[model samples]
Target: MSCPRTKPAWSSLLGNSRLTTIPIICFGHLSIMVQVGDEIPSISLCEENPSDYVDLKKELAEGNGLIIGVPAAFSPTCSDTHIPDYISSPSLSSAGKVFVVSVNDAFVMRAWGKSLDKEKKSGIRFLGDATGAFTKALSVDFDATSALGNVRSKRYAIKTVNGKVSGVFIEPDNTGLDVSAAQKILA
Candidate 1:
């Protein structure tokens, strides 16, 4: 029998690492084959911006898209290193549509988006995969019950062009890494 008060996936990822204070946390190794030629997921979700809800097909159709998956928002790696790098790095411009995806509510995503220095948000958009629908499609969703209370997605990044994944960077240890850092991808 499953416990009614089970652990949550969010709590763990947000709490697992040691990046609580830093503004730009960067992870190192990733091992996943979300390589080029793979079609990105066709999913839709509400954006923090009331007027900017995202319809994956429409958004991905526009141009190259950067889809970032995180265990949870505000987690050490996510807040301190992972996201800050992408939002601030000038090289990130190459990926046309930059989005941060987490299994959090719209409000949380919005707050997190706003927390970043205003300048960092210039080229990035924070999106809520609140329902985990998109995460399930990607096959990265995991049972993060110890802290997050339910299933959640892993920390990862993928680049898509014309709706097909061209590059995928997934943390091998499933912790923190710069799988899709602008400096590495841009060069």
Candidate 2:
């Protein structure tokens, strides 16, 4: 026979009353913590290209690029808020291009893209953060050691020119304000 689920002990402690939990702790919603006007570090990202990956030094040459860093692909926050804003925003117009990055594998990133909008391909390129070597170099990696495995990147976006960051938008809270949704920057 299948085992039945047990009631959570915390709720039972409420004496059958549905007591609303109060905020006892103020969580740390750190900003990009990494600043803007800082020189962007060059890092390799995997493209759909046959060579499996592209060189960051070569790809970031001659134009501006919007590099978006997400904590993980397919997570509720990232899916519902982050990447969708970038794909839907008209203001993300730049002389260069836009790329969405996460520490997931290439396949997961691709699947996330298709779920976001398969019809609108090419507007946003999904890059794989398979090893997170690149994310670490940018100083955005946070020790999500509790739930999310090893170190992970915090959410943020940067506009880079010739590999130097000119503009940045990092979420104060991990729930809202995706970088591509920055109308002023886009304008």
Candidate 3:
């Protein structure tokens, strides 16, 4: 019996070759992970509340800044070590407009920020990527369902100069506490 389905363009190009692998070009949304020299995505993130949104692209457009991506808010490693390290770092003041981004709601991010920097001495802003839009825009969102119950960003640190990435530090294991640490980035 002859198959009724028409062959795809790629299959027609291959012409019945017994190739084990075929390359296909898809005209769909392609996500490219953040890298050095890449411009910050024009995605809005929430601050203290859901209604208050901040455009990161605009915020970092004219300054030296640091964007820190943590898997979740209030998590053990993130709360205890990661963020605190940046808060206490002497280099922090020079880092300029430091932002801590988490795949959480604005209320949760605000509370977590308060819990960590009680006096707000760190001057580090906590941003909420509620729908993971910002994280996905940077192509850093990971399937953290087994751990945090949903998609979360990989542990990463990006140094930006005028909204363009100058440095990218991402933990290879997705949620480790090493390469993206404040001490290393600040130094």
lDDT of each: 0.75, 0.69, 0.91
Instruction: Looking at model 3, report the run of 10 residues with the lowest lDDT sum.
Output: 1-10
TM-scores across all candidates? 0.74, 0.70, 0.84
Worst 10 residues of 2 by lDDT: 20-29
Clashing pairs in 2: none
Q: Model 2 off-target regions past 4 Å?
A: 1-38, 48-51, 173-187
lDDT of 1 by residue, 1-187 (tens): 1223434445466675664333433463343445678777677766875455687767887588888888898888789888887777777777788888888878888888888755555668788888888887777777788988878887888888888887877776555576655556656
Q: Each candidate: RMSD to true structure?
A: 13.1, 9.7, 7.1
Cα error of candidate 3 at position 22, Å: 13
The true-versus-predicted C-alpha distance at residue 10 of model 2, in Å, is 27
Off by over 4 Å in 3: 1-30
How many clashing residue pairs appear in each of the predictions shown? 17, 0, 0
Backbone clashes counted, model 1: 17
Residue 109 of model 3 has an lDDT of 97
Ranking by TM-score: 3, 1, 2
lDDT of 2 at 128: 85
Pairing residues by index, what is the TM-score of model 3? 0.84
